[model samples]
Every structure is written in C-alpha cells, then in structure tokens.
Target: MTDTLLTEPDAGNASEALHEDRLWRDNGWTARVKKNEDDDGWAVEMIKDGEAEPALVGPWTMGRDKKNPKPLDTGAFNTLVKTASEVLRRHEQQLHAQLHKRMAVESGDATIEVTLDIVPDEDDPYALLTAFDSFGEQLAQVKVAPNFKLSRASAASWVENEFRRPG
Candidate 1:
C-alpha cells in the first residue's frame, strides 16, 4: 500500500505546509501523522485495525530537511509497527520469566524443598503464565500478553504475597 498525504485546506498555509500522511494498514496495524493540537509539531498515531483505539501515539520527528518530514511510507511504517510490537512482547515475556524464576516449592525433605513450574498459555494468546508448586498448587500467575505488561514492582509484590512466610 502506498502512503497518502492528507492535508486540511482550511487549516491555513502553515498546516498545509506541514504535509500530513497516512501509511498502510496491515495485520491490524496502521500508522498516521497529523498536526499536534497543542503545538505546530506533528504526532504519529499507531492504531490497531481491530481495536477501537490506537495502540501507540508518539511525537513524529522531522527528517534531515528540518522543514518537512521524510514522509510516512508503508515500508517504513510497517517496520516501525513490527519493531514496536516485538519489543512490547519480549518485555512481557521477560517479566513473566523473572517473576516465576525466583519461586520454588518442595515438601518432605531434610530441608524445605522448592520447585517452580511456569506454564504459558498456548490456546489463549492473552492468557497468563501460571506458576505452580511441586504439589501442583498454584503460587502466582502473570499475564505475559503484549497488552498486559507486568511491572517489576508489581511482580515482586505478587511474589512476596504468594510466598510470604509466617513469623
């Protein structure tokens, strides 16, 4: 898909000169550029096709010309969307791994035994990674879905709450 430049004629000469562009939509991802409401600068909005809202919105930087942008082409916008999605996905996976890695469960041993089993959901893409003990008891579960990000502080708090020992 080719990029289409959509400019508002009534927005005056300054807005017309800004040159807004709308990139292609692929696999539920679309990229568009528009003038920022607050400033003369431009902003890029990455909207997912299936969703009712945009997945990401950020400031759009001008090209080397400084006066104009490089233009939002399909190839460049698609690559950017893919990279952004991948980064978010990996971040979620890493958080899930770290949260489950520190847990352990053990019973009937000279010292208390510890074992941790983390099961990622294959059927449901958005399902959480559930942590289980040696006896198959659930300890904690974290949503590794790209849209559901688990912060380090939240993960640590969950672990503390799950594995808290009585004094």
Candidate 2:
C-alpha cells in the first residue's frame, strides 16, 4: 500500500546531485507521484523506457497524515512497471486477435479451414481470406476488405463456389 524506493545514485555523480524522493528511475522504468488535478488526492504515473507517455496512471495512497501523498520507493516502482507491462502485453494480444479471424467449414467430403487476417496499412488497409484443406495445404488465398467477416456459412459457400479474387 506504500511506495518503495529502488534506485541507486549514479556512480559517476555520487556527490554532484542529490536524488529526489518524489521521482524514481530504475529497471528501465520511471515512477512519479504527483497531485491529481481532479481532486485533492494524488496520482502515480509509470513510464517505460523510450516511451513518450506513461504506460500506467492511477490514484496513489495517502501518507500517515492523510493529507500528503505516500513516498515513492523501489518496491512501488517495480510493481507499477510490472502492472504497466502486463497491460501493454494484453492490449497487444487483443489487437492481434482482432485482426485475425479463423474458422472451419464442411465442403463436400473434406473440411476446409478458413482464415481472415487483416493488414492495417495507413494508405491501403486490406484483409487476406485464405482456405486450407484438412492436410494444411493452402487451397486458395484472396484479398478482401479489412471489414470482411469469415464464418462457417461463408466458408461453406466459398468452398462450394469457385475461388475468385475478391474485388
């Protein structure tokens, strides 16, 4: 519930500068605690290396007096970084899943697997709807719009009909 400090002073600048208690930099991330503009409470922001914005921002706990914000420490910094990293990871996973869709349909005596993968290009966004036989051999590949949907019925119809390049 309390902030922990985990940074060591730079070896070269041992006596040149003094470290501040509110800001901490360590383990490829920085944790900073500041007063929240929306209320009298405090907020903590955790930023990873080479990133412009903080990966995580949330309310911070109060100190013993219940007026000032709790101090930032090493333990708190590490926890914040871990949480932020996880959030970034999950977001990437969800986005990847959203861009790729897959299904299988019965076409004649054979089962064909259909996959729709969307390429989010800035100038020209498109999707690739591919069909594979039961043995994993690619049967057909066609380009479609990014908003294209691939379902069992669509797959069955696609297999029933001849494979044509979608316009």
* Whole-model lDDT values for every prediction: 0.53, 0.78
Q: What overall lDDT, based on C-alpha atoms, would model 2 receive against the true structure?
A: 0.78
Off by over 4 Å in 2: 1-20
lDDT of 1: 0.53
TM-score of 1: 0.45
Worst 10-residue lDDT window, candidate 2: 11-20
What is the Å distance of residue 84 in model 2 from its true position?
A: 1.0
Lowest lDDT 10-residue stretch of candidate 1: 9-18
Give lDDT tens digits, candidate 2, residues 1-167. 43444343344543342224566766676677788899999898877666778889999999899998888766777788889999899988999999998998887788889999999999999999999989999999989888887777777777777667643
List the pairs of residues colliding in candidate 1.
104-115, 105-114, 105-115, 106-113
| Winning model by TM-score | 2
lDDT of 1 at 118: 41
